[model samples]
Target: MECIVRPAQSADCDHLMGMIREIAEYHNLLDEVKINSQVLSADGFGGDPFYQCLVAELAPEQEGKQGQGIGKKLMSEVAKLALARGCVEMKFTVAEWNVRALAWYRQLGAQDKTEAGGWHCVELGGEALQRLAGDRR
Candidate 1:
């Protein structure tokens, strides 16, 4: 099978949104995805682009299919795009439970800076967020 990786365009808003929702669903966080097509287009291809995305499409796979190479190709394209955009580096967070993704990132020479205390992320959602808003009271 042939795999193609390419930078996203404004016309790809719907497809990109679908992929995002699919990923969110895979992580069991479907309800947390608030960004729609317009938001994605604005953030990615707007005046001040925040970030970029690369998509991998499989042309056709014979008898048995393998996705490893395709994934690597996609990452390679993403890295190229990042460098072209004058980004010193690209970063993405993965859940601690996703060992496979972690391994893949490591294979691609991604550093595990979690131990450096350089990055911190805070998320508020679900019932905890409701309680924080005094909604239960």
Candidate 2:
């Protein structure tokens, strides 16, 4: 399968969301998903785009193959995207127990801050996020 990693367009909302759900399901966190395609398209393609995305998929003739370096290609493209966006560093959080994903990341020369530098991953979302934003006034 010749996998092509490419920048995602607004038309890819459904497929991209499906891939997101797939990953969420893989991590046993499907119930945590709340965003829909409209939000995805807006956040990804709105007046003020929040982020960029890349998609990796098997070629049309090879739709069902896994572990075919597609993900790595996608990540590689993401690295390029980050660089093009003038980012100096790239980072993503992985669950502590997701050893497979951790290994894959390591293979890409990504350092695990938790294991290597004793850093902690933190988040402030939901009501906390709103409260913090509201405190600005």
Candidate 3:
């Protein structure tokens, strides 16, 4: 099956949302998903977009193909976009428990910043975010 990778259009929001929910569910974080297709469309296609997304659609002619180079192709396209935007690096997070993904990324030449650079990913959100914003002293 041939995978056609391209920039995601606004019309693809529903399909994208489905994929997002599937990933979140796979990570056992489905409850953490707070956005819907409406929010996705607004945040991704509205003025001053926060991020860009790519979609890889497989040709439907082939039925039972798996473990192909689709992931690598998607990542390659992402790298091209990052380079075009003059980005110094491309970074993403994956659960440490996902050994398969970790191994795959390592094979793809991705460095483990958490291990080598002693970096910690942090989050400040929900009520904590509101509290911090309201603190003006």
Candidate 4:
């Protein structure tokens, strides 16, 4: 079996958007999706790029196989990119109830930061963000 982990391009926006919706559906949050493929393409490949991401594409014929490892491969590539970009740490949130994701990340030496280092994952979005900023519009 073979796989590829590569930098995302504008052409991949649609596929990535599909995956995002799929994941959102898996989490029962499909209604929260507000962005589309165009937004993803511009933000990712625009003049003032906001972020970087990697894409993993597995061999189409590799089915009924054990240990696909597509995600680990993608993360390894992203880790390299982060290091090259002078980042100290990589961060992303996973739903605590997603046992498979939790186990996979733990296997890669990730820890619950709150437990290990007394760090917390905090977020403020939408109304909370505007309220905190004292913006009424």
Top candidate when judged by lDDT against the true structure: 3
Model 3: per-residue lDDT, tens digit, 71-118? 888999998888998998878898999988888899889998999998
Poorly placed runs, candidate 2 (over 4 Å): none
Q: Using TM-score, rank the candidates from best to worst.
A: 3, 2, 4, 1
Which wins on lDDT, candidate 1 or candidate 3?
A: 3
Q: Which stretches of candidate 4 lie over 4 Å from their true place?
A: 60-66, 134-137
Mind giving the per-residue lDDT tens digits that candidate 2 earns over 37-105? 999999999899998787775667767555877777777788887899899888989998989889898
lDDT of 1: 0.81
- Candidate 4, TM-score vs. the true structure? 0.86
Positional deviation of 87 in candidate 3, in angstroms? 1.3
Q: Rank the candidates by lDDT, best first.
A: 3, 2, 4, 1
Model 2 TM-score relative to the real fold: 0.88
In order, the Cα lDDT scores of the candidates are 0.81, 0.86, 0.88, 0.84
Tens-digit lDDT track of model 1 for 107-135? 88988677566666567987998889996
lDDT of 4 by residue, 27-121 (tens): 99999999999999999899999978787776777652336777778889888888998998877788879888878888898887866798878
Candidate with better lDDT, 3 vs 4: 3
